[model samples]
Target: MGACPCGTGRDYDDCCGPLHAGVPAADAQALMRSRYSAYVREDADYLLRSWHRSTRPHALAFDEPRPAWLRLEVLRHVATGPDSAEVEFVARYRIGGGSVVRMRERSRFLREDGNWFYLDAVGG
Candidate 1:
């Protein structure tokens, strides 16, 4: 890919690519970025894999008219503990040829076995 879908201003291979390829994320923010890239790439497998086991879904199915991811803005990243953290972000995307929609969320993450996983949405 040319640029990373996570809006990192970096090449995919130098950014989220490694994480998608099974390399562990360096931190909660890194994992959050990789997860955003996964959505853009429509890589459900990676998305499931990077999710916390307790919350991972049985399967991932994209809608017929998948949202075309536009950009991502990471508002904040805070470590709650040695193995837990949170990320707040806004992601813009559109479905088919529709108006852009902005989604904002604060997400929690947990590190286990030296690998970071998306835990869940912390708040609205």
Candidate 2:
């Protein structure tokens, strides 16, 4: 089995595949991890679905020269309220043979109707 992109030391199917397949994430952190996996897979549909409706973009273009996602390091997760949370993470990726790019962000999430959706990054 292939390893998960989220660096959770788990297989893809056991980690984020179910979430990508329409099973709701258990919490904000889980949703964040699943979203990272979506990016790795270039699954724009899953990305849009996991994004908050109000802030979701109309489309995503995963054209050629796509970054090869390396791994995800979750730094911290905090529950701001019963239905809101934040997750700090660092995702590493590389485009073609270029140096790896590390993207660090503290992202917010909102839970509605028993589902968690990414809102946006705090300052990133």
Candidate 3:
């Protein structure tokens, strides 16, 4: 938790730490970054915790060959309210063969229990 999971030039304390530490983020972009961190660390519980139940699967499996996260680029973010938002982003990674892949998607989010949760992927 000491390192910034978002790989941003700031410390965790200045980045996604506040959201993970129970402090609510003011908008969708902040929540999106924290969710990225959750993916990097393979924190399934955290991912589940921050996922909207309606769209969330009963269980999530992260069985892909471990890959290093090269970068996370947030392309755009739009918020409708404290409880609804959308973010478009690309997450790049390098696999064992040194093959790089960029996952680009528009993600939806909703706030529940005063915490923002990932809702679903709305194809871009």
The number of the candidate with the highest TM-score is: 1
Instruction: Give the better candidate number (1 or 2) by TM-score.
Output: 1
What C-alpha lDDT values do all the predictions have? 0.95, 0.94, 0.81
lDDT of 1 by residue, 28-67 (tens): 9999999999999999999999999999999999878888
lDDT tens per residue, model 2, 11-51: 99999999999999999999999999889888999999999
Write down the TM-score of every candidate: 0.97, 0.95, 0.85
RMSD in angstroms between candidate 1 and the native structure over all alpha carbons? 0.8
In Å, residue 24's CA in model 3 sits off its true spot by 2.5
Off by over 4 Å in 3: 1-3
Per-residue lDDT value at 121 in model 3: 91
Model 1, CA-based lDDT: 0.95
Clash numbers, per candidate: 0, 0, 0
Worst 10 residues of 2 by lDDT: 1-10
Best by lDDT: 1
Per-residue lDDT tens digits for candidate 3, residues 25-119, read 77778888888887787777777777788877788778868878778898989887757889999999988888799899999988876777888
Query: Which structure is stronger by TM-score: 2 or 3?
Result: 2
Cα lDDT for residue 8, candidate 1: 87
